[model samples]
Target: MSQPSDKALVPFVSVDHMMRLVHRTGLEEVLRGLADYIEADFRRWELFDKTPRVASHSAEGVIELMPTSDGEVYGFKYVNGHPKNMKEGLQTVTAFGLLADVGNGYPVLLSEMTLLTAMRTAATSAMVAKYLAPKGATTMAMIGNGAQSEFQSLAMKAICGIDTVRLWDIDPAATAKCAANLAGQGLRVVPCASAEQAIEGAQILTTCTADKQCATILSDNMVGPGVHINAIGGDCPGKTELAPGILTRAGVFVEYPPQSRIEGEIQQMPQDFPVTEIWEVIAGRKAGRVKPDQITLFDSVGFAIEDFSALRYVRDRIAGTDLFHPLDLLADPDDPRDLFGMVQRAAPER
Candidate 1:
């Protein structure tokens, strides 16, 4: 019998390997490269398959499947969100993803997307801020200080040149951990006492709390003009971070309207609420920030296309590198038509 061809083996990136890859390639470079890929995809947004993620909601959490394709390559991510998981010492979110060739329907790469999602989410936030945040912006207020806080700050530094990040969370220990993690990252990290203090003097206010309720992480009064709001925590149907008044006052931009309207911050508004898709802004079909004083909101809900772009970027970077291992995921018989013979031969050898 002949050995399985390369096509039968899928490249797998484990968690340890992913961390090594990040360290080997540099975190900032990876963030910037992911942003580049996401921006490129957004510019050609009309060419890909788009749909709201299929979700199964429960009292404790929700599981989701986010899928997208560009007609040449196909990608999808399986992710879950459970706020109570932290109490169990488990992650609030976890994910894995794959990329496949559209021509032959064969998977090319499989990766641990938990860390990659953190990077991609931050990259998406920073990329949106580059287009919508005030010109010459240098400070950001990060409202949540969990696993995502450091990534968001670093991505902003890499993409938008943000020099200072003010951190605040309900738990001081979380804030401390985030600050400690970002000590030598070349950015000024200020751990604030309250949400109001965190937003002070910040041009980009990012809310990423993990409460699965209509929780107000930021009040309307706390929000001021000329600030770009990256609201990522309001991802599920009932989960939100910003006050309804904030949505009413800001010019909201979203990834996909169909999904954003159902799962983003705009879910608080009327069904006919006016909002612009971010892809149009990247494509130059619509303006991002016309005036510096107009409040802008990016109600991010973690779209499939962003994951697709991240997978594409990782697949490219791991090429010819020791960052991935080959997995014998598919069965390739010596004769394509002789499936029973192959099974019988393996059974006898066993």
Candidate 2:
């Protein structure tokens, strides 16, 4: 009979361990690497197994699960969005994710995804902007100042070369917190009184408010020609940000059409409404920002492929590092037909 060996077992990663990984890898490098993964996934869009996200909505908040596979590897994330959580000294969102091997259906790694979601979301925005944003988008206006503000701001500055940030939120304290967190980040941070004031004369405009309903944060008059709007929030069925009129006037871009049609700002429009998927641009099959005077909008509802790309990124970047925990999601039986024997052996020894 074979006995268990003395070899070290799999290591588990905690939230603090992940933070250390981020600090060691550096945010800019991670963003750049994640962007490359996202771009590659988008380029081979047909190979991926895609689906609309599954959601569970409640009066207080909503929880969601996103899963995708690239034929070889599979990954999913368990995430919740509770806008009122801040009242209880918790983040509005909490998440964790898993990556598995499709051939064997065994979980290879598990890690906290709340902070990683922020990183991936910001990386995705900057990635889309790399293709859709104007050649030199310097000044960006951030309409929502919350937990995601600092991450988004840093992503733009590092990836898109944004030199100035204009911030505005309904709550002054939220804006103050955002400004304070980003103190001395090389970019000039400006706090504005209203959304209109914040977006005035900016090259790039990002709206990431956490409101659960259809909120018209950007109106037709507020949006100027030649502006790139990165819509980060409003990812669910009833959630929307741009006024219907604004969508009609601008060239709207999306990550995946099948899912975005149901979750993106395009949800407010008819099925026949014209919009371009960013993958086509990345693959050189379509054009992005053809002219400087053309208004462009990326209705980002977030996607599973981005998470898949993120898992791939973290795995490759932290290969030897301890940022991942080996999860025993699958039961391994020494003998295929002796599962009950293993269970009996594991029961309290008498």
Candidate 3:
């Protein structure tokens, strides 16, 4: 076998390469870039083919495939959420994604989405907060200090001008880990004793706990008026984080109602419970925060379109750089009709 042509190889961003790329480009810069891409796609949301993620549930966890296409490119992510994994010294969520040319159906880029998902999730939160968060909001209450805590804090800082993050978790060690990681990241990190304490004096309240149950991370009385709630943890059918009273009081916003109604905080509400799509708010077709006293809730259930945007951003940003390796993932024969001949010709190398 000679050398494989470039068309047969897809660019693969490994975990190491992704870390180097984030370091080289600056982490906050990448977060802001992802936010921009997500926002841009949201502005043209009607152009994409959207659907709820396909999920397979088990006793331990759930695996999902999120897919979307915007006429030119198609993207999908394979992700798993296992809250029990944390206690087993493993990641609660891990993912990988691919982007392909819609016309030719050949993958153009493949990358680890474990880091990318964390970044994009935070970016999506902050971007929505930009439109719905109280004006001039600078402080955010980070209620969950898990793997996503640092990314969410920095994204808010970089994208929404938030300079202070008050961190809290049921586990003090988790809060300590989050605070220590964010110590020198240009934000004022305060360790709070409880979730209520974390939200004190904060304009934006972010909840990201991982219990895999309908536990109330934020109670009704704990949440006051005029704060924006970025609820991102409840991503499965039986998982939730907020009180029903909070949802009834807040003006709820969602990415896609079909998915959010099944997997978000709004899952606690009735089937006909009113909710506004965040894309409409982003496109200026609906209201965001009309009054300071009105509570704004973004019941975020991770959507496929956001992953498509993040994948698109990674593909464009990694070009002309040695941040990814070429993966011989596809078999490209000289003649499209003779796949057997191409395979037989390569058998001698084995």
- lDDT value, residue 149 of candidate 2: 88
Cα lDDT tens digits for candidate 3, 67-121: 9999999999999999999889999999999999999999999999999999999
- Write model 2 residue lDDT over 1-350, tens digit each, in one string: 23322121233456887788878878777777778888888899879898888889899988999999988999999899887888889988888887777997766667778888898999889988888888888989999998888888888888899999999999999999999988987889999999989987688999998877899999888988898999988787788988999899889999878788888888999998899988898899999999998889999998998888887877776677666655444556677598798677777756
Q: What are the RMSDs of all candidates, in order?
A: 1.1, 2.3, 1.0
Worst 10 contiguous positions by lDDT, candidate 2: 1-10
Better of 1 and 3 by TM-score: 3
**TM-score: which is higher, 2 or 3?**
3
Angstrom error of the Cα, residue 69, model 2: value is 0.6
State every prediction's TM-score relative to the real structure. Answer: 0.98, 0.94, 0.99
Deviation of model 1 at 89, angstroms: 0.4
**Model 1 TM-score?**
0.98
Report the C-alpha displacement of residue 126, candidate 3, in angstroms: 0.4
* Native-to-model Cα distance after best TM-score fit, residue 33 in candidate 3, in Å: 0.4
Runs of candidate 2 exceeding 4 Å displacement: 1-12, 347-349
Scored by CA lDDT, what does every candidate get? Answer: 0.94, 0.85, 0.95
